[model samples]
Target chain A: MAIRWIALRIIQEIIRDRRTMAFFLLVPIVVMTLIYYALLEDEKAKLGVVTRGVARFYEYPLVSVIEEDEDIEIVSLDIPDKETDPAELDRLIMEEMKKGKAHGILYMDQQLLSERFAGERGAIHIYLEGSRPTSTAAIFSSIAEAMDDLTETMPVVIDAECSAKCANSVNIKAIEIKKHYLYGSEDYRLIDYFLPVFPTFFVFFFTFIISTITFQRERVRGTLERLLIAPVSFSQIILGYISGFIIFSSVQALIIIGYILALIQISFTPHQLFALGVTLFLIMIVALTMGLLASFMAMNEFQAIQFIPLVILPQIFLSDMIWRIESFPLVFQWISYGLPLTHANIISRKVMLQNQSLWENWPQLLSLGGFFLFFMLVMSLVALKRNKNN
Target chain B: MLKIEGLTKRFGKLTAIDNLNLNIPEGLKFGLLGPNGSGKTTLLRMITGLIEPTHGKITLFGKWTPTSRMIRRRVGYMPQQTAVYPGLTVSENIRFFGRIYGLSGRPLEDRLNDILELVELGDKKKEVLSNLSGGMVRRVLLATALIHNPPLLILDEPTAGVDPVLRLKFWDWVDLLVKQGVSIIITTHHISEAERSDQVVFLREGKIIQQGKPFDIMKRFQANNLEAAFVRSTNLK
Candidate 1:
C-alpha cells in the first residue's frame, strides 16, 4: 500500500519539471517522425530519358513497357535538335543528377529503332548516379526490366528460317513469375525493417538515463538516508522506483507506437500491440533496476553521467539493433546474449515482423524474468549497504 | 530507555567508535558533545538503527536486538543536513513522514496541523522545500522529525542555523517532550546548549573521555563554567 505513495511521489517529482514532459513525449515523437520519413524515401526512382533522332521513338512499345514498372518513373527531357551535341545532353543529365532531380539517365540512340526494325542487336547507354545506393539499385533493376520486355517477347526463329512455314517450328513459351511474401509486400522499404527496433532502442536509451539519474539524485541529496530511517524496507524502495518508471515508460511506448500508427500508417493487431508493450515494460524495469544499482556505484550525478559510456554505449553497439546478433564474433555474440537489450530487440522484432503470440515468447520472457530477479537482488543488497554507510 | 554495550564501529583502518557503553533512561535529555570526526553522530546513527555497530549489543525498551521496524518507528531521527525532498511541499512532507509511522485519517491530519503550527510554518505549509529560506527549511526538517511523536528523538545539531531566541523556544519545546516521558538525544557544539542537558558525555577519538552532568563535571574539574570544564576535562589543556 505504501509503495503507491512512494511511486506517486517519485513520479510527481519527475513530472514537476517541464523538461520531463518535453523530453519523454515531444523528443520521442520527433525522433520517430524522422525514422518514418527517412524510410519513406526511394519508393520510386525517377529516370531521366534523353534522345536524338527519336521524335517518334517515344511512341514505341517499350515506352509503355518501361513505364509499367511500379518502381521506376520516366521523365522526358527534350533534346534541342537531332544534331544537338551529345556533350550538351550529357551535361544536362549530369546537372539533373547533381540536383537530385533524377536517379539516372537512359540515353536512347537512333540505332534503337533501326536495329529492332532490322532484327539486329541494339545498344543504349544507361548512366547511373552510383553514389545514391537505394535509388540507384531501384533504377538499375527497372532498366533491366525494360530491356527484358523486348528480348523475352520476341518470337525465336529456329535454324534461322526465312519461310513463314518455318516460323511454325519456333517455340514461344509464355513465362510469368509470381512472388509471394510471408511478412510484407513486394515493395518493402528499409523503414519496415528499421521501425521494429526503433521503439525498443528509444525506450531503453531514455529510460536507462532517467532511471540512473533519478536514483542517483536521491542518494546525492541525502533523501535516501531519510527514507532508510522510515519504515520502508529495501525491496519496497527498489520496487517503488520500478513502479514509477513503469508508469512513465508504458506511456512512452504507447505514444511512440500510437504515433507511428496514426502518422506513418503502420497497422498493428491487438496481440502485436500487447507484445510491443510487454517488450517495452520488461526492458524498462530492467533498466530501472540497473539504474538503482548504478546509484550505489556513483557518488553524485556527475559520476552517474560517467556511467553512460560504460553501461549504455555498449548496449547500442552490441545489442543486435544495427546488425544480426549472429553476425557478431563468437565471444561478442555471447556478450550480446548476456545483455538484456538483445532479448528486448528480438522480442520487439518478433512482435512487429512475425506478430508472434505472447505465449510463444516464453523463452525471452524467462530471460527477462531472470534479469529482473538478478537486478532486484543486487539493487536491494546495495541499497542496504548504502543505508548502513549513511 | 536505551542501553548500549561494547559498541564498536570501524571503517577499514580507522575506528570511529570503540568499546563504548552507556545507559539512557526515559524522560532524560542526554547531550552527546564532541569535536568533528568524533563518534557522537556515529553513536546516534547506531541508536537510531540507521547503521550497524561493528561489535555491540543495544537494548531498547527491554528489546535486545536493534534495527527492528518497531524500534525504527519508535525512534525519530533528524540528521544535520537538510533531509527533506526539495520537490515536495511542506504539507506533503509532513503527511509522508506521518504515513511512514502508520499515521492516517484524522490522526495524521491533526498531527500535521499541530506540527506545522509548532514549527511556525502554518503559512508556508503549501510551499515547496526548494523555494523556502534556509532557516525555514530547517524548521520544516524539525517539523518532520516531530511529526510521528516517537518515544525517542535523535537530533543531530538541530539548532545550527536558528537564531538564539528561536533556540530558546526550541529547548522549551524539548523540555515539554521530556516531561511527557520522551527521551531526547541531541548533539550540539555549543557549550551553553550543552549545559541545558540533564547529562553530558564528551567523546573524542571514538571513545568517551568524560560522562556526567554539566554541573558535576564543572565542579570535578575545578572549572568556572561548562566550556572551561570541557576544556579542562579533555587533554587539550
Candidate 2:
C-alpha cells in the first residue's frame, strides 16, 4: 500500500508538471532529431580533380558516366606551370580542401596516365579533407569506380588495333571489390550505427535528472521525513520510490526507442528486440538508483542539478558511447568500467547490432545489477543517518 | 501515552534538547510551547522518533524507544513544513496518506471525506495544494495527519498560519478528538493557543521553565493570560 501511494504520487506529480512532462517525453525526440540530421550522410560528393598533362582523363566517357551515375561532382583543376613541383601541388590540394571547395582531391599525374595507356600498373593519389569522413569516402569510392571503369574498357579499346605482344603485356585487370559486412549492411548510415546508444543515453540522462530533483524536493518539503515517521520501513520507502520512478522512466525509454526505430527504419528480430528492451530496463533501473543516491548528497533541487556534470557528464564522455573504451588510458578505462552506462552501451550495441542474446551479456548485466544494489544500499544508509539526525 | 527520561540531544557542541524529561498521559492534550530556538520542535521530533536522542530514552505506549511498526502505526506526525505534495489535490494528498497508513476502499473514502469535512476543506478538496492559500494548505496538512485516525497525533506548529476563525475551529476539532480519547502532542509558539491544552510545558533553552494547567500557571505567575504568565515565568518582561 505504501509503495502504491508513493508511486502514484510520483506519477501524478510528473504528469501535472507540464514543463517536466515535455522535458521527459519531447526533449529526447528533439535531441535525437537534431543528432540525426547532424550525423546524416551527405548524398553528393564533390571532388577536385587535379591533373598534370592528364586533363584528357577527365574528358573520358567513363569519367562522365561515373560522374552522372554515382552522384559525384567532379571539378577539373589546371596545373600551373610553376606548380610542377609535387610540394607545390600538395599545397594547392590542401588549400582547396581548406576552402571547402571539395570533399577530396583526386590527383592523376602524367606517369599514371601513360602507364594506364601503356598497359602497366599505375597508382592514383587521392587527398581527403579528412573532416567529413562519410563524404570523403563517397568521393574516394566514386573515383575508384571511374578508375575501375577505365581498367575494364581500356583493354576493349586497345584490343581493336593492338598487336599480339601489346595484348599479351596488358595486365590491367579490374580489382573485384566484393563487399561483406560482419555486423551491419553496406547501406547502413552514421545514424544507424549510433541508434542503439541514443535511447539508452537519453533515457538514462533524463531519468537521472528527474529522479534527483524529485527526491530532493521530497526532502526539502519534508515529505520524506513524514514518510520516515510513517509505518513504512526505510527499505519500503526506497523500493516505493524506485517503483515510482521506473513507471515514467520506462515510458520514456519506450518512446525514445520506438521513435528511433521508426524514424531510422532499423530492423531487429523479436528476440533481439526483447534483449534490447531488457538491457534498457536495467539501465533505467541503474539511472534511478544513481539519481536517488545523488539526491541524498544534495540539499536542494539546484544542488541536485549541480550533480549532472559530476555524475552524468563523465558517464557520457567515458562510457564508450562516443569513443571506444579500449582507446582510453588504463585509469580512464577503469573509470569507464565502473560506470553503469558503459556496460549498458556495450550490452545495447551487442543486443541490437550484433544480435547477441541477453545471456551472452550476463557479466555486463550483473555489473549493472551490482551498481543498482550499491546505490540502493548507500542511499538507504544516508536516509537512515539523515533520519537519525533530523 | 509517552514517557521520557533524561532526553538530551546534541549537535556537535550545541545541545538542542538538554537533559529534559516529561510524562504525557493518554487522552490528554499536551502542549510544548517555546519561542524559536527554545527546542519545542526538537523535543516533539525526539518523541516521534524523527531524531535520535544523544543521552536519553523515550518510552511510547509502555515500549522503550518505540521504533517498531505497531508503535509507528499508532502515531501520526505532521512536521512544521507543509509536508504534502503541492501538485496533488487536497483529497489526493489525504488519500495517499490514508493508503500509506493501510486504509483503503470504502473505509478510506469515508474517512477521507470525514477528515476533509472536519478540516473544513471539503469544498476545496479538489483544489491543488499549490493553488490553495497558505491557511488552506495548512488545513490540508492537518487533514492528512488526521486521515488515518491514529491514537497519538503529533503536530508541529499545526496552526501557525491559520486565520483566527479557522484556528478556533481547529481547536474545537482538537477538543473533539481529545474527548474521543486521542492523545495530542503539539508544539506551538503561540502561548495563548497552548491554553486550550489539558497541560502545557513551557520550555526555555531546552529546559522546562513551567508546567501545569493554563489557569494554574497564570495564577502562580499572577498574570491574566498564558502569554503574560509565560513572560513572567521566563523573566522575558
Candidate 3:
C-alpha cells in the first residue's frame, strides 16, 4: 500500500508534465514512423538487370509484377554490343555493385536461346553485390518468384537422377525455404526491437534520475533534520523512498505497455510477460542503486543534470539493444559485462523471442536477482553514511 | 524523546562535532545557535541519524541506535539550503514529500492544502518552484518539512531567506507545532530568533561553548542577546 502511493505520485508527475509526456509518447512514434517509411521508400535500393538482346523481355507479364515495387529501382542495362565487349559489361556491373549503386547484377546469354536451345530454357546468371545481406536477399527473392511460373512453360534439360532430397536433374534448381517465427517474423522493424527492452529501460532510466535528485533535495530542504528528531528510524526513511520509486517506475511501465498495446499492433506471448515483469523488477533495483549512488556524488541539481549523459548513454549502447554483443571488442566487452542493462536486454530478448519460462532462464534470473540484492546492500550502506545536510 | 551522549564527528583530522552531549526530552522546542562552521548543523544531523557520529550513540524513543525508516517516520526535517525541486510545481513538491512520508488519499490532500495555506502559497500551488522567489521557495520547503506532522521537526535556518514578517509567521507556526507536542530542534545564526527557544545550545568551532535557557544564558553571560553571548564565548570582543 505504501509503495502504491509513491507510484501514483509518479503517474501524477507524468500526466501533469508536458515535456516528459512528449518525450515518452511523440518521440518514439515519430522516429519509428520515420524509419518505417524510409525503409519502405522504393528509391533506397538500385538493381542493375543486364541481359543480352533482352529488351523485349521487360514487356513480359511476369517481369511487370514486382515485389515492393516502389521500394526498389530496377535499371535495365543493354549489353551494348555484347559479343564485342562482354568482359567490359561484367566489369562495369561489378563496379556498380561495389559502389552500392546497384544491389544486384543480372546477365543473360542470347546464344543460349538460339537454334537447339530455342525450345529450352536459357541460363540467366545473377550476381548480387553480397556487400549488404538485406539488399542481396531482396534481389534474389524478386528474381526467384518471377522465374517460378516461367520455368514451368520452358522445356529444360536434366543431367542427374531425381531424389527426394538433393535432386539435381532439373534445369532450374529452385529451392523453397519454410520460415517459422517465434515472436515476430512478419514485421521485423526497429520498433519491434525496442518493444522488448524499452518497458524496462524507461522504468530504470526515469526512476534513477528522479529518485537521485529526490534524496539530495531532502537534505537540502532540511526535511532530513526534522525526521531525525522524530520517533522514526533511518531504515524506514530509506524504505519509504524505495517504496515511492518502485511505485513510480511501475506506473510508468504500465502506462507505456498500455499505450503500446492499445495503439500499436505488437503482440506478446503469455510466457514472455513474466520475463517482462522480472526484467522490470531487476531494472528497478538497478535504478534504486543508481539513485542512491547519484545522491552521494552530487550536492546540487546542476551536478545531477550532468550525470545523465554519463549514466544514460552508456547503458543504451552497451546493453546489446542496438547491436550484437559479438560486435564489440574484448576490452569494451568487459565494460558491457559490468552494466546491468546488458543482462536485462539479453534476458528480455530471449524470453520474448523464445517464449522461455522462468526456470529455463534461472542462470540469468539468479544473476539479476544477485545484482538486485548486491546493489540494494550497497545503496543501504551509502545511505547509512550520507549526512542529512550534505 | 531524543537523547545524545558524547556525540563526536570528524572529517579526517578536523572534528566537526566534538563529544557533544544533549537531550531533547519529549515535546521541547530547542534551538541550536552558532557562528558559521560551528557544527550546529552537524550535531542536528547526527541526532537525526542522517550522519553516523564517529564516537557516540543517539537514542530515539528508547532505541539505542535508530534505524533510518523509524527515524524518518517520526521526524520532519528542513535543511538550511533551498531544497525544493525547481522543475516541479509548488503543489507537486509538497505532495511528493507528503507521499514519501506515507501520507495519501483524502488525509494527504487535506494536509497538503492546509500546509500550502499555512505557507501563504495556497493560491500559487500551480506555480513551478523555479519561478518562485527565494523567499517563497524557503516557505515551500518548510511546508514540505511539516507535511508529515512528525513528532519531531529539525529545521536548519528555516527563516534565512524569509522576510521579517514572514519569518515571524514561520515562528508562529513553529510555536503552534510545539504546543501540539511536536518537539523541534532548529539551528540558526539569527540570535534574536534563537531567544524564543525553551532551551539554547551555543556552539563555536565544533564545541558547545554555552548551554542553557535563553534568559538564563543571556543573564549569565552578561550579554544583551544570544548573539552577544555567542560572540563573547568566542572571545570576539
Q: Which candidate number would show the highest lDDT if scored against the true structure?
A: 2
lDDT-based ranking, best first?
Answer: 2, 1, 3
What is the DockQ score, from 0 to 1, of model 3? 0.22
Interface RMSD of 3: 5.4
* Cα lDDT tens digits for candidate 3, B167-199: 898889889889988998988889879888999
What TM-score does candidate 2 reach?
0.75
- Whose DockQ is higher: candidate 1's or candidate 3's? 1
The TM-scores of all predictions, comma-separated, are 0.73, 0.75, 0.61
* Model 1 DockQ (Cα-based): 0.35
Query: Model 1: per-residue lDDT, tens digit, A259-356?
Result: 66664335689889888888888888888777777767775675577565556655765676765444344676688778888888878866776566
- Judged by DockQ cut-offs, the docking class of candidate 1 is acceptable
lDDT of 1 by residue, B126-194 (tens): 999999988888888888888889989888988888788878877887888888887899998776677
lDDT of 3 at B229: 76
Say which candidate scores most in TM-score. 2
RMSD of 2: 12.9
What lDDT tens digits, residue by residue, belong to model 2 across residues A1-390?
999999999999878866556657765674464344334423466776666666445446655766775557776554464576778888777677656577677666676656555555656677765433355567657767787766655553234356665656555655333222234555566666568888889988988888888888988899988888788887788788778877887788788878888966458888977887888888888888888888887755755776765677667767877654544546766888999999998888777766668898899999999999998889878877876775
Clashing pairs in 2: none
> Of 2 and 3, which scores higher on DockQ?
2
Which 10-residue window in model 2 chain B sums to the lowest lDDT?
B228-237
Ranked by lDDT, the better of candidates 1 and 2 is 2
